[model samples]
Target: MTHTAALALASGLGFGLSLIIAIGAQNAFLLRQGLLREHVLPVVAVCSVSDVILIAAGVGGLGSLLDAAPWLVDVMRIGGAVFLLVYAALAARRALRPSAMAAEEARSGTSLWPVVTTAMALTWLNPHVYLDTLVLLGSVAATHGDDRWWFGAGAMTGSIVWFTALGYGARLLRPVFARPVAWRVLDALIAVVMVAIAATLLHGL
Candidate 1:
């Protein structure tokens, strides 16, 4: 393969690996709703749409500016770490809370608009998201000479496919999550994932 093609492939893989496996607030929320059997399609729809917008923004040279302004990236890193930590704490609290109350809160009608808004915020507000998709992924793509667009395309494709599978796939596990204990376990797992990611981010600083 040519240099540009190689870069495109590597960049696409890196972007996919970074994002595809990480279970974030979006995934947790989707899983929760899937378990409850509520608004699954709409929830996934909003999430996938938000991700496409953010991923496109990242690949379109927005992430490149951060390289010149290292401090800005640092600020984002810190801010994202703090946000993740706060989310982790909240998840932990929910895990410890009584199941009946938690179920009620989860079942309560949450406006689809708010969920979309929240998904957008989660995908876009974090500096790390831009850094990962725009800066890091874009930088790699730039190395590929002219075919960099393909790299971005592949990466974006990965994001769309992954989220769609995750949001919808959660439904397949409905039978398993029927137990109250299963919900607690899922909440605890989400908290752990968030805290672990936050710790990794902080350690880099």
Candidate 2:
């Protein structure tokens, strides 16, 4: 493979690995829904699809535009920081709130559209997603020169594989999350993760 191709492969793997390892809002929501064993497929499908679309858009031709438009990056940075901070506080509030004694399973009866809509909103609303996929990862792809498209494709491929694996894999933990404490613990962890991301974003700003 040419040098650019190799770089693209490595960068794609890096982008995927960076996201897969992070337990952010998206992953936390997925894990919670997964533990509940409700609407797992729809939630995961939405997350994966959203990622693909963003990655494609970022890589298709917007990398240079984003780079040139420094003001846009600044806007995204500030917006992302504010969003994460608010989300972090909300997560903490959810953690502190008392839960019902009964371990109520998430109602999976709703049509799949709710699942899809919620996932899309969560992923798309956060400016951090733009920072991660559109700015950071897209910039990496741009470095690949003519092979940038392949790099974008590879990065998106990773999202598809990951969400599918995580969604299906969560079924294995259904029994453990049957307890109310399990959910509280999971939510608490999620809160911590969100707070950390928020802190990081603020610090960077």
Candidate 3:
């Protein structure tokens, strides 16, 4: 790659990682799925791939359409809020009734579809994601001129690296999460955060 392209890629990687490396519904859900060590690959794939699409769309100028439509953002906001509230309830229940990963896998009856669905919902349903990936990232990428794609590629790399680390690396914490109390704590935190995020979304609407 050229020196300019390298810089653009590095900038994109940094920007992408900064935006996603925070506490949010998507990360929370992914973390939970990772801890369970169930469908980790698929979950990671969904998040990483979705991010790539969003970043690509953003860099490709889809941001203009998304920007032009206020109703679209509102629709996403409402849907995201509703989904978050429901997810919060589920997290709360899990906190109240904690169980080991083994038992959860055995009796949970949670097939791949639901897990994938939740991952998609947690990702695409979130309004911030659209704005961040499409508008914000797109605008920033535009500053790179012809090298903007390099920036987007860098950002996509960041997403893949982050999701992979988060999903696969979660197994490293298995010892800590082995205790039911640890799960209860994690789930409780997730519930509280999800509710707070949902409330923020509603208030913004």
Per TM-score, the best of the predicted structures is 3
lDDT of 3: 0.91
**How would the candidate models be sorted by lDDT, starting from the highest?**
3, 2, 1
lDDT of 2 by residue, 1-205 (tens): 7887777866786676676557777887787677666788889888888898889888876667766877776666666556656656655555566442132223334466665665775687566777778777877788888888778777887888878777778879888877756766776777687677666656665
lDDT of each: 0.69, 0.72, 0.91
| Model 1: colliding residue pairs | none
TM-score of each: 0.78, 0.76, 0.95
Instruction: Compare the candidates by lDDT and give the number of the best one.
Output: 3
Q: Let me know the TM-score candidate 2 reaches against the reference structure.
A: 0.76
Pairwise TM-score winner, candidates 2 and 3: 3
Better of 1 and 2 by TM-score: 1
Angstrom error at residue 86, model 3? 0.1
Q: What stretches of model 3 exceed 4 Å from their correct place?
A: 99-110
Number of clashes recorded per candidate: 0, 0, 0
